[model samples]
Target: MMLLPEGSFDFALQDVLNRNDHFQSVTEGDACVGKVASLLLYVEPVMADSGCLQVLQRFVSDETLQAVAIVDDKHNAVGIIDRGKISDIFLRPFSRDLLGKKAISEIMDKQPIVVDIKTGIDDVARIIIDSGVRHMVNGFIIHDRGVYVGMATGLSLLKEITHRKQRELFIMAHYDLLTGLPNRLLFKDRLLQACQNAKRLGHLLALIFVDVDRFKAINDSMGHAFGDKLLQNIASRLAASVRQSDTVARLGGDEFVIVLQNVKSSQDVCGIVGDIAEQLRQPIPIYEREIHVTTSMGIALYQDYQDSAEELVRKADIAMYEVKQRGRNGYLLYAPDMEQQDDIRMSLETQLRMAIDGGELSLYYQPQVDLKQNCMIGVEALLRWNHPNLGSISPAVFIPIAEETGLIIPIGEWALKQAVQQHLEWIAQGLPPLRVAVNISAVQFQADGFADKVRRIVADSGIDPAYLELELTESGVMSRAELAIKTLTDLRALGVKLAIDDFGTGYSSLSYLRRFPIDRIKIDQSFVRDIHNTPANEAIVKAIIALGDSLGLEMLAEGVENQQELAWIMSHHCREAQGYHFAKALSPADLRSWYAQSIVIKCP
Candidate 1:
């Protein structure tokens, strides 16, 4: 193929559509044998006698002599022609005689000093001047491998070259400068393109959406210079993981996208996903720490032919959420069932926000009894939501939702204040002051101004700080030990008690107990509920009680139902207890009334 090298400067359109240095195929010679198709006013040959002189009246009137160039089957530009030449020789003088006597090929110049397909306008001008040809025939031909494919008048080719150059500039404007990867704008374009490709392939294509986990934290701690370097490193690694046929893009920030093409089956995807997960699992060292933050990848697979780009991205996002739900550090494949769950969760989240705002929620205290006395000494503040229509909602379900949506911070605050208020009221009425142990979620503790909020609530409720206890799960504190201690220490300084709720069930290290200011440990209900039958439960309960004693932390046996379990707990010096073995979570008024008349209820 030969390119009109110097003439390329003539039009941006050529630059826009054509970039390869390839030109129309041509042999040696500054002069090429221009073809009749481009030079002659040639239409689809009418298949009449060769003597018919065909004319294009429309082109003849519009274009100039400079606009015409022609090439042969070998891509050789045999000669050049222009519109004016066609009109002069055939249409103006001897018009009728020429029309009947000869075809365009017969009259058109057989050889003129011509422009090679590769000849620049600078050189071609030299040829026209050298040949002293008065006029050029119709237009220029652009050929691929010696074949006649297109005609480009010098003017049209010049215009095309100009237009194409401008479009290239447009691409440079929008595309990412580094890695030559698409920035957000181009990524969206490619995402759309990928969706179309997936539809055409009759196979699946999955978008593996990845956000380098905690990339900002690393970026913040390590400095921006290092962050940029790390990003480059990551981009390289990620790009290497996919096929040459696929696209790996940085969607700005730490987020990236992988466009998987021509996927054979879901397992092929699963294997790739697992490999990616493992590759990311390896710690990326920055500075001193072998900082390992695993990805939460969401795959939006092409499951149906009807899906669009927006739907695919949304599905991938939804799948990423499921990975987060499964406790992060992994991936979730997009599924139809997950969409249903997504809808339900969104609905529940909406209703839950309303529940907090409209004051449709409250704390229900369940009495914690002394296993030996069979009498209540303290109560765990079990949160209950009277949903007005849905009735009382369980903690098991919404506690998680609250934690996720951050609604637990406010709801928990309300519960703490209400519980304290009720406990204070019991004391003022000459009833025994029950220690109010309110369950504290990780979200509540990690909240901004948590210590301040708790202090204010205790003060406002007029409850003795000593009679208040904050109960956190052992697992929760263990996960964020430093932050938990800072939060826990501030609360403990206010003179309220603190306990690890649901202990021995979570895999809490022994070291966790020494890290924070905890006053008590409550054996999880699972152990107590089955202590009679499972020797493992009995042994675990005893060891926990013993460990609590050794640590100088008070012990409570939760779910000490029936006489055998009660007997076992009391015998082990388990001092505080609560479960269905006592009363289920109840309103403060009900508990007060029950305490006023109830006998020494023995476990049966």
Candidate 2:
């Protein structure tokens, strides 16, 4: 084998002109090469009858020509001669002298890689790769309708493939596939640019964060295809609601963002938001049904906030969460107080992560008394957190945060296990076994394998499952009614009692309520709070108790604080009650002592 000379081929002006013309005629701007014709090089072909020395002379004259096609008298491609083979034949001692007068056909490769001009680049590439690396070095002959035209190099093929991959990566990185909108990465870049422009021009810029309200519920109910179509439709509306100079981007899943440039004032921002709300709220036809949609919008103005791009985005997100907290389907401007509140919540979230392992969490028992018998019948286990630095925190303050961050799943499980162990401990203390109610968070109740987890806890604790009552909120069970029914049925099979806590507070369907395998309903504290004075409160309480009676479910009133409230509940024939009227939630030892002294009738 002989190595061909490096840089032996000349890159002439004629060849450059030919390449430019071929590119302009056959290829579009920056797109992947579509056909072999797109990469054609105007390397002239040699006649088969030409002298071998003539071919050797032609090769020596141009170093850039890697291969030359051998054509018949009719100008159809017949064969090929690569530089290396021709050079090898002549480099031998006195070989050129002997073969110089011989016909070029004597040395031309009969089996060359030949392809049609219309052949796809990818197919040509595969053929070249499958044949051998020598074909790439020698190049392939391309013809249009069996007539020799030009050739294509492996280098050009590789370049086009690389460009295609890069284009694909760019789209994946900067755009959402589902909505064809700019994604988070592109959104951040545009936001930074907008902030710089606003600062330099002394103009206002607003960053708006938009989140679809209860999108998960809708998605779960209507299927993911419907959800994806909904998001795409929302994206179009959002883009249309803003200026072309501004940007609309999807930050993933039901959350989108907009960058508004050259804002006149907060009033202008308000008007734009109002229009967006109106457009988004219009009913979307999905699955042959019209579905109403709503979004929560939070806006942060650059001039008003005077912060970095990241801080502006953070402020907008905080304001959006505020809208969700108050109730969705509205927008709000970022206020300084909201920042303080967000900061406190962030700090608390950090602390709560460590609270479980740091021994900062404990259960306080609240006694439930049977008003008819005037005796302690059961107790609800309440989770209490005492921060090492901040002292005791109310469940109302931390429970929602827990649910949002998904910490409630583990926390709720721990609470259930602790309640079960406490019941066992009380039995060991020579006290009669009483039903222990554990409040379950909605996040925990809807979690996968929740019934299995409860079964394991009860089985491992060596306690009777009937004495372990799991209290679920009406909203928790009603959110996913079918799943809730299945889970409740499984737990009931385990022989554990179930109750709907804060019963009247949530939107529970009467149909769903009748289907749920619950043993009791705890009247929410709100209705029981002012039952003695407020007629509306009294009416709600009466209605809940009557509903419970009609369903053959035991009713327990919460927050029975005074004698008048207790009198009203007792006269209404509600059998059970629990609140400050008896005693506040007490520690293990305190509750044990309080129960012994407070019991009017002792259990057998």
TM-score of each: 0.62, 0.69
Q: Scored by CA lDDT, what does every candidate get?
A: 0.68, 0.85
Best by lDDT: 2
Q: Clashing residue pairs, candidate 2?
A: 8-63, 9-62, 9-63, 9-64, 10-62, 10-63, 10-64
Tell me the tens digit of each residue's lDDT in model 2 across 425-543.
98899778888999998778877788999989978888899899999988778766887899999999999999999988888999999999999999999898878889999888889
1-604 per-residue lDDT for model 1 (tens digits): 3455553433433233345322222111324322222232222211122343433443445453243333444445555444556556665766767475664444445564433344454344344334432422233443445544444344443343354355445555555445445667777787788778778777688888886654554565457877876676677777888888888887777777788988888788879988987887776666564544577788988858688888888888788767766656788788888898788678777899999878888878888887566777888888877787777777766676777667887788888888888888887887777788988986677556888998888777767899999998875676556667888889889999999988986767778677778899988888888687899998888889888888888888887668788878887788887777667877878887877776746233
| Candidate number achieving the greatest TM-score relative to the actual structure | 2
Off by over 4 Å in 1: 1-184, 209-258, 262-264, 271-297, 323-330, 505-507, 527-529, 535-543, 561-573, 601-604
Regions more than 4 Å wrong, model 2: 1-119, 137-151, 165-187, 200-203, 208-298, 317-332, 357-359, 369-376, 404-406, 424-432, 446-449, 478-486, 504-515, 526-552, 557-604
